[model samples]
Target: MEISLILNNELVWDKEFKSCKEYVSNLKSLAPNEVKMREMEAKFLNLVNTDKDVSKYYKIGGALCISLLTNTTFAYADTLGGVSDKLKTIVSPLIELLAGLGYPVTYGMLITGFIMVIMGKKSKGIDIIKWACIGYVGLQFVPFILNILELIGRELRNSL
Candidate 1:
């Protein structure tokens, strides 16, 4: 009979089995003969090497595998943590100073721009307001952008 695994009102898995032991046995018997496995591996490699798109995907998969394997060691990460601690000691105060100043600058520019526009100096006022708004939004994204760049750099370093 068919066996089904349901979870949260969804069919998670469905298979045919005579008994629970048979299901467990089938799961355990996943090994293939060495000669057949080698032949299949060779065939897969040949296919990947011969096809440009497949080769690109294979290279990407290989790079990901290499990155994952290289980053599994904590020794390098501990050194980075030490460096980051040093950098934080130096840069954290500077960052806080800038953040403390940025909001007032943003508000000042916005208020001045609106006042100018209300006084009929429309063109320059609108330009200043637009730039101030853009700067405010851009400042919010700085941390997100830095995080993305850091992730990219780490992956590139690992792949290399």
Candidate 2:
């Protein structure tokens, strides 16, 4: 249950914390500048590389958890109120990429599954074919689902 705090490539604090909140508070108090914060960030990166023990201790949010470690304005994100169009613009590339890859993969899977059926793996082949068709239909529905969500969001935003 020992924690080592490194600053400027040297260990400055080595002790045990009774709780994760205490550890986080101590960490926040220990690193007050960009350099120290960067060092702390590097330590976290190293922890991510070595083991997932750090994740067990900090079980809050996703990458947003890193923002809580800093007070800089740039670390925070704004509400999605004014960014609907921007979100669509960003997601367009993903939808395009999905459409580009979807057909070929689905067809390939269908052909492979048919081959497996001819090769005597009947149940496995049928399962593969079923899954491939399901995936294809789900992907085909993606744009429609997103459109419905967009419409809902628009109505909510307009009502507000």
TM per prediction: 0.47, 0.47
**What C-alpha lDDT values do all the predictions have?**
0.85, 0.83
lDDT of 2 at 3: 89
C-alpha RMSD between model 1 and the true structure: 19.0
Tens-digit lDDT string for candidate 2 (1-160): 8889999999999987578888788888876799888999999888876777777555435545665676433433656754767777888898799787988999999999999999999999999999999999999998899889988987898899
Collision pairs in model 2: none
RMSD of 2: 20.6
Candidate 2 Cα errors over 4 Å, as ranges: 1-81
Q: Native-vs-model 1 lDDT?
A: 0.85
Count clashes in each candidate, considering only residues at least 3 apart in sequence or on different chains.
Answer: 0, 0
Candidate 1 structure quality by residue, lDDT tens digits, 85-123 = 688779988987886777899999999999999999999
